[model samples]
Target: MSFKNLPLLGTAEIIGALNLSPKQTAAAANLAHRVTQSAWRRRPPHKSGQTYEEFAAAVSACAWLTMFEVGALLILGRHHDARILTEASRSVHQAAHTGRRR
Candidate 1:
């Protein structure tokens, strides 16, 4: 499946919704990138696209999963900023990219 090239989204509203400072959001983004790269490194070339397409797929998958997680956490009243900033996005992106390769 081909992923549409999504426009880069503004994160100000999302950050406010999550009650995360810019610093925390940036940290999460950096961690997610690293994890995505690691996942890409292990992806089989025959199963994945060029760097841009594969990365786009990974990012799109990550965003969708993160939104679902954050929404669920908010509904359950379990959203913790530290937990989110530290590991949530990283794990989500890693899983997304890894699964995308199969």
Candidate 2:
């Protein structure tokens, strides 16, 4: 059981995976769950439609959360929790050697 292979903290992939529908749901969880407003012209996407402008009047913009790299940043999370992976890996190792999932 070794956690030396893992590093903490990774941003989720959610750049343009959001949209609004024709009607609102009972509740909106996040920007992804917002409903579309009327007078919107374009081929509607699925309930959670997502898209951005291809051309702009000015230069294209680029933005992201700066917390991904900041002074004295310490990540307390993992893509897959190392603690759980250690146990699962140990189990797999045991099963490979002893033929048991336990």
Best by TM-score: 1
Tens-digit per-residue lDDT, 1-102, candidate 1: 111332234344555566765455555455445545666777777846658456646556446335433543444456585357438677866898899999
Window of ten residues with lowest summed lDDT in model 2: 55-64
- Sequence-dependent TM-score of model 1: 0.44
| Error of model 2, residue 6, in angstroms | 12
TM-score of each: 0.44, 0.22
All candidates: CA RMSD in angstroms? Answer: 8.6, 20.2
- Please give the TM-score that candidate 2 achieves against the real structure: 0.22
Error of 1 at 39 (Å): 1.2
Which residue window of length 10 is worst by lDDT in model 1? 1-10
Instruction: Find the candidate with the highest lDDT and give its number.
Output: 1
Mark the regions of model 2 whose C-alpha exceeds 4 Å error after superposition: 1-76, 100-102
Clashes of each: 0, 2
What tens-digit string does per-residue lDDT give for candidate 2 at 1-102?
111111222212111122222221111212111111221234345522433322111111111112121100212234244345445655765678686544
